[model samples]
Target: MNMMGSLVALLVALIWKPDFEEWRLGWDIKLFARIFSGIVISGMAFAVIVWCVDANGPVFVSMFRPVRLVVVVIVASLILQEPIYSGSIIGTVILVGGLYLVLWAKKKEMKSMSNPVETNRTDRNVV
Candidate 1:
């Protein structure tokens, strides 16, 4: 975080040679508070995502990507009053199909492991 912040600061310093007056945050407490709150909420959400990965395993995170697409479509159409394009519909179909394929493959893998020859005793945990 520090390194990224420093790199961004350096970039801005090089690109925009501003005076101290402009650099100051000023007395816009409401805007500052809203921005700070957003940062905190985002951090909390990220922490929750980490916990989900730890609990459900890493592959679980990938499952949510397609859902994000659905959310974007809904938010754009409803909130922004934007029209949904045919391309977005096609992409959603593709995403759903791909997710189904992955789930089917994972099921097949587990089913095959049911055979005595493939079974092995281990201390691995499963949910």
Candidate 2:
């Protein structure tokens, strides 16, 4: 389904531009290497995400999005020499904080589930 969506987008782009050069990949080794690396990395990431969703559920897997964003920002800044704006830093901090909150909540919920409290009741009709 994802591949189908990508194919549809590619078709639309081709139709809208109708220029073969825009759709063509020339014989550039750097371009080829980048495309290859991107495809391999994205494919492996997608596979891992699917496995995580199956094993830990969607909420657990969804946390990876912010982690991925943070990683990308770090990598782009360090490796690609990209500039990091103040907004990016603030957003990253917020994302990390939210992730921590979710994780803490999950831990607390799991703890509660494992050790449910028992109530001693004196009156059955008490509300």
Q: Which candidate is the best by lDDT?
A: 2
Per-residue CA lDDT of model 1 for 1-127, tens digit only, reads: 8689879987898679656665556569977897887799879978988998998566657776687998899799999999999998998888888888887886777678775475567867966
- Could you give candidate 2's per-residue lDDT for residues 65-109 as a string of tens digits? 778889999999999999999989999999999999998998898
Q: Tell me the lDDT of candidate 1.
A: 0.80
Model 2: how far residue 123 lies from native, Å: 14
Steric clash pairs (candidate 2):
none
Candidates in order have lDDT scores of: 0.80, 0.88
TM-score of every prediction relative to native: 0.59, 0.68
Q: Which sections of candidate 2 miss by over 4 Å?
A: 1-18, 25-43, 121-127
- In model 1, which range of ten residues has the least summed lDDT? 18-27
